[model samples]
Target: MSNEPVGVLVIGAGASGAAFAWSIAGAGMSVLCLDQGPWMKQRDYPSNGLDWEERGLGEFATSPNVRGLPADYPVNEQDSDISPLMFNAVGGSTILWAAHFPRLTPKDFRMKSDDGVGADWPIDYQTLEPYFALNDRMMGVSGLSGDPAYPYHEPPLPPLPLGKSGNTLAAGFEKLGWHWWPSDSAILSREYEGREACINLGPCLTGCAQGAKASTDITYWPVAQRKGVKVRSGCRVREITVREDGMADGVLYYDEEGQLQEQKAEIVVLACNGIGTPRLLLNSKSQQHPDGLANSSGLVGKNLMFHPYAMITGIFEEPLHGRRGPVGCSFWSHEFYQTDRSRGFVRGYSFEAIRGLGPAQTALQGMVQGFIPWGEDHHRAFARLYDHTATLLGITEDLPEDTNTVTLDPELKDSHGIPAPKVTYRLSENSRKMLAHAVERATEVLTAAGAVETVAEPLMRGAGWHLMGTARMGRDPKASVVNERGQAHDVKNLFIVDGSVFVTAGGVNPTSTIQAFALYVADSIKKNIETLFDDA
Candidate 1:
C-alpha cells in the first residue's frame, strides 16, 4: 500500500454524511468525517421557560460567530431576502428540522409512469423499501400503519400521541370522506432505545432539548463515533483532489484556523447536501476536467428542486395548546399524493395539520394581524390564539426541469474567498398547479374543521424545504452526473451521496430517501473497494 492513508474520507457531517460514515465504518473500513460546523451537544438546545433570544434557539443554535468557509462561518445578512436559512452545525439541518419523517409513497418513485410528467427514479420504491425500514428502526420513528393510500408500512415501536388538532383534523377527514392517517415522525413516544419519550414541549424546530428527535447528532453520529469513526469538525472541504489517472485521491480543505490542508484516501465520498455538493464540485477545477471535477457531462448543478409548501393558519375560538407537542404530529392527508391529470397538475401533494404556536410566536402572529401594538389587545389575542389556533401545511412535489439550477455567483464569495452558490430557480407550471390544488384542499379542510378564519400562503420559488435533483443519477452519462449507483460517471473513486443524486423529488421530506441512498451507495463501495484502490 502507498504511504497515504488507506481509509475513506467523508465530507459534510450532516444526516447523509454521518449515516454514510457510520455504515462505512461499521463495515470495518477506516473512515474520516469532516464537518464545517461545531459539535453541539443536547445541552446546547433551549429550554421551555427561557427567552427565545437568550436561549440561542432557531438560527442561532447552529450558526455561531466565526470566520471561515460557509459551513464554519455563515453568510450574515440583515435582510432575509439575501439570507438562506440553514444550519452550519455538525448535524446539518437536522439539528433544527421539525422531525417529520414521513416516507415517500410507491407512486413517488415512478413519476413518469404514474404522472406522465417528471422523470422516474432509476430505482423503484421496492428497491428502497428495505433501507427505509432500516432507517426508521435506526432513527426510532413513531407511527401507525394501515393507511389505504400507501403501501403497508412497518409498525413503529410506539405510536405518537394525537393532540387536539390531530383529533379535529381526523374528524374532519372522516366527515369529508378524505383519506387521513397518523404522521410518521422521528420522535420518541414511549422511550425506546434508551431515550426519553416526548414531553409535548414543542421545541423540535429549535433543537430537541429533551432528546426525543432523532437528529444525526443523537442517532447515527453517536454510534459511528463509538464504533471508532473519526469526526473532525470545523473542516471545510473545498475540492476533491484527483490523481492524473482521474481517480479521486482525497480532498483539500481549510481547517478551523483557515490553514489549507490536504488528506489522501483510498476513496472520497461527497455527502454534502444538495447545495453544498454542487458548489464543491463546481469549484474543483483541474486540467483533466476543466469545467469542474466530475463535470464531463456538464450536469453538475442542473435540475434543482424544492417541494413547494403552503401554510394555512386557522384562528380558533378557544386555546388548543399548540405549543406543547411536536411541530408535525397528528393528522395527515395524502389523498392527493397521486398524479391527477384532471387537476391540471402532473404531480400531487400531501396536507399535514401541525400543532399551534408558543407564546412568543403567538405574540408575533397577533402583531401581524394588526392587533393593538402591545398591552391588552396583544395579551387577549395571545391568550385566545395560543391553544385554539392550528396550521395545516402542505408539501407539494416539484418536477425536475433543467432550467432550475444552482450556479456560482461571480460577484459573491464566502469569507474564504470561494464563490457562493447562487440559486436561480422558478416554480414550473406543474408545480404552480399543484400549489393551487393544495391551497384549495387545505382551505376546504380548515373550513370543514370549523375554522373561524383561514389564510393561504402560496408557494414561492424557494419556499420549499425539500431540496434535490441537482447532480442527478441516471443511466445515460451524457445526461446525468452520476450513474444509478451514485458513482460519478466521470470519476471512478468519487461518489455523491445526498439529495443531490436524486433523479426525482418526491412529495415527502427527503431525509429518509437520502439516508437510504447513502446506504445503497455504501454497499456498492464496500463491494468494489478493492478494484477501486487497484485502479487508483
Candidate 2:
C-alpha cells in the first residue's frame, strides 16, 4: 500500500464529483478523483447523421466498470424493448444529459414547512443561491433573466436561439396568459470560458461532439485537472475503508484490468450518484459498523426519489423543423411548480416544450408506436414525425419514500464480484396523480397550440430519470446519513455531495443543483478542515 495521502478523494467524475473536485482543487487541496469508467473525447462521438445504435458508442452494451457486467440498459430479448438507461464514462451521465439547467425554487428546500410532505433541508435556497450562480457560470449556462418563479440570479450568458418549437410554445403560453421563460440550458450560445458555441446540432444526448453542451469533461473536470487534481478513470470503487474510530480513510477499488487496488486519503467524498454511493457504503461492512461505513443512522440507502415524468407529443400539420436545435432547447409554463391546493398531488411539475426526432430516433420512435415496423409506411411516418412532431416533457416532483430504495441484491453480483446496486422503486400515489395531471395539461397545451393529433405516454411507477435522496442530508443525524454540509454523520472524514442529499425532487433537471450543492459542500469542507480532522 502507498503511504501517500490525498487531501480529498472524490469518487465518481459525474456532475457533482467534477464540481466538488474543481472547487476543492481551486481552494488548493490535493484532490484525487476516481471514476469507474473511461475517458471519451469529442472525436469518439458519432457523426450527426449516424443511426441511434451506431451513435450510442461510449454508451454501448459494454460495461465500462466491470468487464463482463451487463450494460446498464439491457434489451429485452423477447420484447426487444430497452430497459433503464445509464451512461458509464468519465463525464458520467452528463455525457448523455439533455442539459436543461433549471434552478430549484425556494419552495423546494422548505417542502416540509410549506407543505405537509417530505423532510425540510437543513440548508435553504438562499444559502445555496450563490453556489448556484457560481455553478451556472462554471457550466456556461445560457439564459435570459427575470423568472419570477425563482429568486434573482444574474444570467450567466445570453439565451440560445429559440427554434420553431420554442416559438410555438411561447405563443401558446402567451395565449393562455401564463408566464413562460426560456429554459436555462448548460449549452453555450456564444463561446464562453473559451468553449465553442453550439452549432445547432439537435442531438445533445449522445454526447456533444461540438463541446458546446456542458459535460464535466469540458467544464469542471478540465479545470480541476489543470488545478492539480489527479483524475483516475477506469477505477471502480467498491468499498469505503473506514478506521476503527469511524473515520473514512480511503477506498478499495478495481483497476481497468480488474486488478484490486486501494487508495488512501485524509478525506473521502462520495460524489458517486445516488445509487453508487449507497452501494459503496453497504459494501463497506466493518466490525465497528456492521450495516455500512456510515450506516449508524441506518438511512444510507433509504428515501429514494426520482421525478415521475410524462411525455406528451403533438403532431402538427406543417413541418415544425424539429431537427434545427438541441432537444432541450425550449420551456413550457412553470406556472404549476408549487403545490396547488385544488390538485390532489402534494407537489407540481414543470412542463418543458421540446422538439424531438432526429431522423434515426424518429424512425425508431415510429416503429415502436405501431406505425408499421418497416417499409414505406414506416418511412413516411418517420419523415412526418421527424418534421412535425413536438413534445411537452413533464418533470413532476416525486415525494421521497422509504419503500423506494437502493439496496444490495444478495443474489446478484457484478463481473467484479461485487453485488450490484438494486433499485426497488415504486411511484407514490401523489406522484401518480401529478403525472396524470401533467398529462392532461400537456395534452391541453398541445391542442391549444394547434396540434392535429396528440399522444400522451404517462409514466407508470418506477419510470423516472431524476434520481435523488438516498443519502439525504438533514438536521437530525438519526434521520439522515449526511449533515447539512453533506458530511456523513457516522464517518467524520466522509462526505456525500450529490443528488442523494436532496430532500425532495424539485420540478427540474437536477444537474445544476447537484453541481451547486457539491461546490457548497467543497467550500464547507475547506472551511472546516481543522474541525473535521481534529474531531476525527
Candidate 3:
C-alpha cells in the first residue's frame, strides 16, 4: 500500500469538522477529512418520498443508539435515560436535525462565574461572536436580530415564518407577559446561494428534500471540496499514531474494504462530538500515553452531558395548521434562560413551539400519552389528536458531573471490532426541578391559549441530541483535556474542534456555537501552525 504524509487530517466531517476545514481550505495547507459513513446525495434523502415519517423512525433516525445501521457503531445506552443521537454520515446529525440554530448566551461561557454551577469555558462569547456571523453567512441562517434575550447581532436572512401554532403560542406568552421570538433556523427563508427556499414539507427532522436545510454536505463541503479539501468517506479511524518525538503523527483506520490503513499527517484534529472523541482517545493507548492520549488529566471520558428535555402537548378544539410549515419548533422563549435565586435551579431552560406530529406519530403518541384510548375508542381518540395538537419542548441546562460519563464497553464491539461507547447518565436534582417548572409553565400557556386538555411528559425518550463536555476546555492542563484554542493539553499536535471541548451545555441548540468554535479554532490553528508544539 502506498503511504503518503498529509498536512492536516480531520476526523469526523460533522458540523465542527466541516466548518473548520472550510475556513482553512485557502490557507495554503493540504487538508484531508475522513468520515466513517458515505457521502449521501440530497436526492436520496428520506423526505423525497411519501414514507418520510417511517424512514425517520427507521434508517434516518437521529440516534445511532437507535438507527443501528452498518455504518453506525452501536452505543450502549442501557444505563442512561437519554440515549445519544448522532448521524455517522458526511453532514453528521445535521442530516437528520431540525435545523434550529440558537447561539449560547454570553453567560453560557461564564457559567462558573455567573452561576457557580459548572466550569467556565476557556474562551468567552465575544471571542466567538465574529465567527458566529461568518458561519451564519456560510450556513444561511434565518432570524430577526436584536431580541432582548441576547445581545445584538444581525441575522443573514429574514426570520422564518411563524405559522398558526406559533401565533397561538405567542398570544399566550404575550398575555402572560413573557419573552418569545421567532427562532433562528438553518433552513432558508428565501432562495440564496443556489439553494431553493423551504417548501415547508414538514418533518424536517427526517431530511429536507428541497435543499433548503443547511446541512454542511449541501453548504460548507461543496465549497471546501472546490478549494482542494479532500474528503474520504467510508473510513473509520481506529487510532491516532504517535511519533518518536511524542507528537501525533497520523491515524490508523479501517477502509471500506475492511483493510487496515495508516494515513500520516503533521496535524490531527478531532471533530467527532463528545462521545466519539473520548472513545477514540481512550482506545488509542500507547507506552508514552498508556492511560489514553491527552488524558493525563483523567478527564477524557468524564463529565458527559446531554441537555435533558421535557415535552408538553396541548389538545385544541380547532386545528392550528401545523402540517403547512416546517416540522421543527417555530418560536422560542428565553425568559427563563438566566439563573434566578428564587427559581430553585441555578441555570434555566428555554421553551420552543413544537408543531403537531405526523399521522403515525400522532396515533402512537395519543395511545402512549393516554388521552386516546385503545380498542373501541382508538379512532375517536386519534381524531382528537390529529391536527389539533400543539407542543412545547423544554431543553433544560444539565450541569456537568464526573458520574455522568462515557466509557468503553468491556464486551461489545462494532462491525469493525472496535469497542462501543457505553453511556452512564442520570438526571440531577436541579434538572428534575427545572423540568417540573417547565412543564407547569407550558401547561399554563396552552391552557391560556384555550386548550381543552393537556399532557406533559417531563423526561422524553430519544431526546438526547447535543452530546458535550466529555473533554472539557480550561486554562489548567491537569483539569482539562483541551485549552481555549481546542488544542489538546497533553498532545501538542492533537486538536479537538467539537462539542467535546465545551465547558458547559447551554439550554438551546448547540450546532450554531459548535460551528462558531470550529471557525475560531481553525483561525487559531492557521495563525499558530508554526508554533503548534509550544506547550499546547
Candidate 4:
C-alpha cells in the first residue's frame, strides 16, 4: 500500500467502479482502485474453447457459491427463494452477463408518488439522462430510436438481428396486440472503438471471446488506465477505518499474498454490488460508529431487491435456431411494465425473450421439469426440446422490504476470514401477483406463436443476476444511507456508486442505470470537491 494518501480510493473494480473511476480520473485527481479479483483476459474466455458450455456450467458459473474460485467469497443462499448471482473479476458480473442493457423508465424513480408502493428516489430520470447518454457513447448501446416505452434517446449502433427466435416471438406479440421491442444491448452489433462486431455466439453468459460484449475491462478500464488511474487486483478489503471525527481515513485489506495492509485515502468510494457493499459497511464497526460506518439510518443491509423472476418456456415443432444469436437479448414485451391497480398488483413486469439452451442444459432442465424421462426415452425427449423451445423471462419490479436482507453470517467466511454475506429473501405478495400475471400473459404469447408444449417455472432460482436497493438514496437522512449525490448520509467524503444506492428495482435491467448513477456521482463530486471533506 502507498504511504501517501491518494485523491480518491475506490473499492471493487466492477462496472460502477470502472465508470466512476474513469469519469473522476478525467477530472485530473489521482485515483486508485482495489478489486478482489484479477483482470480477465479476452483470450481465456470460455467461448474460445469447444467445451465452452461445460465451462459455463462449472468454473465460470455466475453464483460464487457454485463457482468457489479463490477470489470468490461463498454466499449462503439456503435461506433465499432465489440464489444471488455475480462475478468478482475486473469487469465484475458484466464479465458473465448477457449484455442486455435497459434503462429504468421515468415512473421507476417515483414509485411512492406514482404507485404508493415504494419510496421515491431523491433524483429522477431526468437527472441522469445526460449521464446515461454519455455512458452509452462510451460503453456503446445497440437499438433503434423512438422506443415509446422510454424517453427518446437514440442508441449508438443499430439493433442486433432479431433472428428466428425474435421474429417468432414478434408474431406472438403482434397477434396478442402487446407492446414489444428489440432489446437495447451493450453487445456491439457492429464494431466500435476498435472492437469487432458480435458473431452471434451462443454462450453470452460466459465471457465474450470476440470482445463484442462491452465488459468494462475492455471498455472503461483501458481508458481509465490511459488517463493514469491505477487498479490493484486480488486485494480483499476487510473493513473501513475511521478517525475521531467519524470520517473515513482508509481501508484495511488482505493483499494478493494474504498479507494485511492499510491504504489511506482522502475520499473512499464503494462500488461493490448491493450485497457486497452493505456487507462491507456492516463489517466496518468502529469506535465512532459502532453499528457500522455511514449506517446511522440503520438501513445498510435492508431493502435488498433481487427483481424476482419467473420463466415460461414453450416447445415448438420447428427449430427456431435460438442459440444462433444472443441468448440473453432478444425481443421483449412491456405490455405489463407499468402498475395497473385493476391487475391486482401495484407494479408490473417485463417478458424478456430467451433463446434455447445447450444440449446439456436442455437435458437437465427437461428432467427437472419432468418431461424427459431417463432409461429408454431420454434421448428422444432431449431431441424434442433442444432447439425448439423459446423462453420468456418475467423480470418483475421488486419493491423494497426491510425483512429481505443481507446480514453477515456467523459461521460463513471467505479465505481471508472475513464474514460472508447471508441472504434472507422471500417473494412478496405483490411480486407473487405480478409474477403470476406475467407468466399467464407470456404463456399466451407462446401459444399464439405456435407452441406445442408449454411449461412454467414460477420462480427462477438461477436468474437472480440483478441485485439492487440495499443502501438506498433519499433526502431524509433518517430513512436513507446516501443522499442524491451518492454521498453517504453519515460519512461525508465517502460515496457509494453501485446498485446498493438504487431506491427501487425497476422492471428492466439495472446495469445501464447503475453506470449512469456512477458517472453522475463522479460529476457531482468534481463540482463539490472543495467542500467535500468539510464534514470530516
Candidate 5:
C-alpha cells in the first residue's frame, strides 16, 4: 500500500541522514528517514555483553558479509583487494568507528587545481568551514586548537589525555620533527550534554557502551525527532520510484515484517552511502530514465575509493597503559598528508596510532601472526606482546579511477532477494608507492620509539572503513551523478547526502566531513527551496 507523501523521504538513517533530517526539519520541512537496520540501544551494545569481544568479532563485525544479519546484505569482495565494510544501523559505521575526527584540508578540495591529480570540488574547504564547526559542536568534538594542519578553529571540547602509548609515539615524532597533533575525536572527554565521558574502554571498534562516542543516533537523531522529524527503522528500501515528469516520487521498500510498501515524497535524499546509494540508483530503472535514476553520466558507481590501508605494530619492552586504552587514534600525524613530487605519489597519507587492542583481538591477531602459538609458551609470548604494543595505521589515499566500482552482483542476493553489491577495486600504483613510503617511515619511528620488534602489514584487505567517490560531485551532469548542492544531475528533486558525493577521498577519517556535507546540503536546499525544482 502507498503511504502519505512526505516533504522529504530520506533513505538510510546513518550519519548524513541523521544530520540532514535534523537540519531540513529545522527549516520547517517534514522529514521521514528509513533504515534497513534497527535502532541500536546502548545497553544492547556488544561491550555490555559478557562475550563482548566475541560478538564484536562476529555479529557486530564491520563486514556485512560476515555479520550476515537479516537487515544486512552480502558485499561481493572476493574479486576486490579490500572489502567495502559498513553497518546497516542508524548510526551506521559510527557505532563501531574509532571516532578519529579530522577535517579535509583545503588542498583536498582543490586537488586537481593544485596537484593536477584528481578533480577539484565544486566548493572548497572555506565554503564548508562554518558547517564544520557547527557539526563539531553537534557531534561533541574533542581536540586542541592551533593545529597547523587545519585552518584556525577550536573543537567543542578539550583534547583527550594522551596515555603512555600516545606519549611514546609523541616522543618519536618529536625526535623526527614531524607534524603531530592530538586526535580530534567525535567522543566526549568530559561529561557533556547528558552523555557520559569516555573511560578509555578500548573496544571502540566494537561499540562504545558508555555512550561517550558521538554516534549520530545519540547526537543528531534525538534533536531531529524533537524538531518534528520522523524515523522508521527496519525499512530497507528496494528502489527509489520516479514519476512520469522525471522527478522523484518516493521509494519501494520492505518493512521490518518483510512486506512490500510504497512511500511517497516530494523530494528524495539518498544517504545510503557510497555503496548502498549506487546500488539503489542502479536498481531504479524507469521509462523516463532508463540507465537507473541520474545515470545519464554513466558514472554512478564508478570511481569507488577504498582508502587502502597499512597497519604497523611495534612491540615494546614495557607496558604503556595497554590494560586501559583508546584503540583509536590518540594523536595523528599529517607530515605526509600533502603531495610530494619526490615521493612518487600525487596525494599523501596520514598516520594514526592505535593505543591498544582488546584481549580477544590481540590473541586472534597474535595467533594469525604466529607470535602466540597454541603451545605452552603461548602465555609468555602473549605477555611479551600484550600491553607493550603500539600500532600505527597508514591511511593511504586512493585516487578516483573509473575502473573501480560498486555494481550489482548477478548471482548473489540478500534474504529479501535483492541483488547484492559487488565491489571491484584495485590498488593504484601511486597508492602502492605511498604505502611503501609510509611503511618505511613508520618503521623508522617505531625503532626510534625504542620498540624491540615491529610487524607491518603493507595492505589490509579488511580496512575499507572509508567508502567514497561512488557518485562523485561535479558541475557537469555528463561527469557526475550529483551537483555541488548534492542535487542529482538528472533528477532535480533527488539529492545525495552521503559519502557517495565525495569528489576525492581525503587521507583521514571521513565521518566528520560527511556530516558537514549533509548539513551543507540541507542548508543549500532551504536557501534554494523556491527555485530548487525550477530547472526541472
Candidate 6:
C-alpha cells in the first residue's frame, strides 16, 4: 500500500545483503532491506536452550529441505541427491554456518588459465584484495599470520586456540609434510566492537548465544541500522516488478500478515543467494521479460553449484578433547588446493580438519554411516566413538554445468502460494574422481598421525551449503547473468551481490569471498551512482 520510493531496495539480509546494505547505507543512501525470516534475538538462539539438539531437529535444522519452516520456501530436490541447506533469518545462512572463514586463493579467480577448465572470474583476487580486508575488519576475523598459502595479510585477532583436536590434526599435517595452517574464523577471540568473546561453547553451527560468532544479525545489521538503514523482517518477496522502460522498478512481497505490498526504489539489489535469486527471477515472468526479469541470456537458473563434500574420520587410541571449541574445521591444508593434471581433476580440493562429532551427532552420523547398529551393540559402538575420533572433510571445487539448475516447480508451492524452487544437480565425473583422490590423501594423513582405525564416506547428501553460480558474472553478456560489477547485463538499474554471481566455485568456504565481492559491488555502485542513476 505504501508508495514511497527509497534510494535502494535490497532483498535478503544475509551475508551479501548485509555487507552491501552496510556499505551503501554508510554512504548516506536511503536503504531499505527486506527479509522473509524474523529478526531473532541472541537469547532466542537454540544455544541458549537446554534442548539444543532437539531444537536443531525442528526449528533450526541446518537444511531448508529438512526444516520446512513456514518462513522457508521449500526446495524440490527429488532430481538431485545433494540437497540445498540454508537458514531463513535476518542473518540468513550465517545463523547456521560454522564461523570458519577462508578466503579464496588467487588462483581460484583464474581457473580457466590455471587449469583449462571452468570459467575464470571476471575480476581477479587483486581487484578484490582491499575489499577482502575491509570485510575482514567488518566481520572481526581471527587467525594466525605467516601462512605461506596467502599473499601476506594479518587477521584482526590472534588465532583461536587449536585445542586438543586441532593440535592433533596439525600434527598429522606436519608429519605428512603438507602445508597446513590455523583456520581463520569469524568468531571473536577477544571482546571487540562491544561484542563479547567466545566462551568455546563447542558447536558454532547452532548459533552463538554469547555474541562471539559474527553473524550479520550481530555484526553488519546493527552497524547498518545505526547508520539509518531500515530492515523489514518477515516479508517474502514474490517477484521483481519492472518498469515499462524494461528496468527494475520495485518488488511485490507478502507482509507478515500475508498481504501483498510493493516498495518502489531507485535501484534494486538482490542478495538472495544462488537458489533464492534464480527462483525469484524465474517466477517474475512478464511481457517485458518473456523468460524472466533481466533473464535475456536464459542462464539465470543454470550452472547451479554446490562444493562436493567427503568426510573422513579417524579413531585415536588416546582421548582428544573434542567438545571445547568450534565444531567447524580448526586447521586446514592447501597442500592439494591447486590444479594437478596428474590427479585427473581439472580443479583441486581443500582438506578441512573438523572436530570429532559430539554424542548426539556421533550417534546420528554413526547410524547413517552404518558404523553403529541399534539394540545391543549400539552402546558399545557409541562408547568407542566418544572422545576418540577426529574428522577431515574434503571440499572439492565444482565446475559450472548448464544441467545443474534451479527451476520453478509446476505443482509444489510454498506457504505463501508461490511456486517452490526445483533443483536438479548431479556430481560430475570430475567431482567423483576428486573426492576419491582427496579421501585417499586424507586417509594417508590420518594414518600417519597414529590413528588405530579410519572410516571415510565418499559423499554425503544434504551437504549443499555453498549455493553459488546460478546467476554468474562475466564479460560476455551471453554467458553470464551479471557484469563484472554485479550489474545485470539486461537491466542497468538491477544489481546482484551474492554467491549467485560467482563465476567459479572455489575449493574453500565461500562466506569470506561472498562478503568481499559484496563490498566490491557496493563500492562500485557508490563510485558510479551518477551513472547508475542517470540510466533511470
- Cα RMSD, each candidate: 3.1, 3.1, 1.2, 1.0, 1.1, 1.3
Q: Candidate 3: misplaced stretches above 4 Å? A: 1-3
Off by over 4 Å in 6: 1-3, 533-536
Clashing pairs in 4: none
In order, the Cα lDDT scores of the candidates are 0.77, 0.79, 0.89, 0.91, 0.89, 0.89
TM-scores, one per candidate: 0.93, 0.94, 0.98, 0.99, 0.99, 0.98
Q: What is the lDDT of residue 475 in candidate 2?
A: 73
lDDT of 2 by residue, 445-485 (tens): 77788888888778833234466899999878899888899
What lDDT score is found at residue 380 in candidate 4?
90
Best by lDDT: 4
Better of 2 and 5 by lDDT: 5
Q: Which ten residues in a row have the lowest lDDT in candidate 4?
A: 1-10
Against the hidden true structure, what lDDT does model 1 obtain? Answer: 0.77
In TM-score terms, candidate 4 sits at: 0.99
Cα lDDT, model 3, residue 320: 86
lDDT score for candidate 3 against the true structure: 0.89
Steric clash count of candidate 6: 0
In terms of lDDT, model 5 sits at: 0.89
Candidate 5 clashes between residue pairs 3 or more apart in a chain or in different chains = none
lDDT of 4 by residue, 247-272 (tens): 89899999899999998988899999
- On a 0 to 100 scale, what is the lDDT of residue 79 in model 1? 22
Show the colliding residue pairs in model 1.
200-324, 319-387, 319-388, 320-387, 320-388, 321-387, 322-356
For candidate 2, give the lDDT of residue 5. Answer: 76
The 10 consecutive residues of candidate 5 with the worst lDDT sum are 320-329
> Candidate 2 — what's its lDDT?
0.79
Give candidate 3's error at residue 43 in angstroms. 2.1
Q: Which stretches of candidate 2 lie over 4 Å from their true place?
A: 1-3, 26-28, 57-84, 372-376, 460-463, 533-536
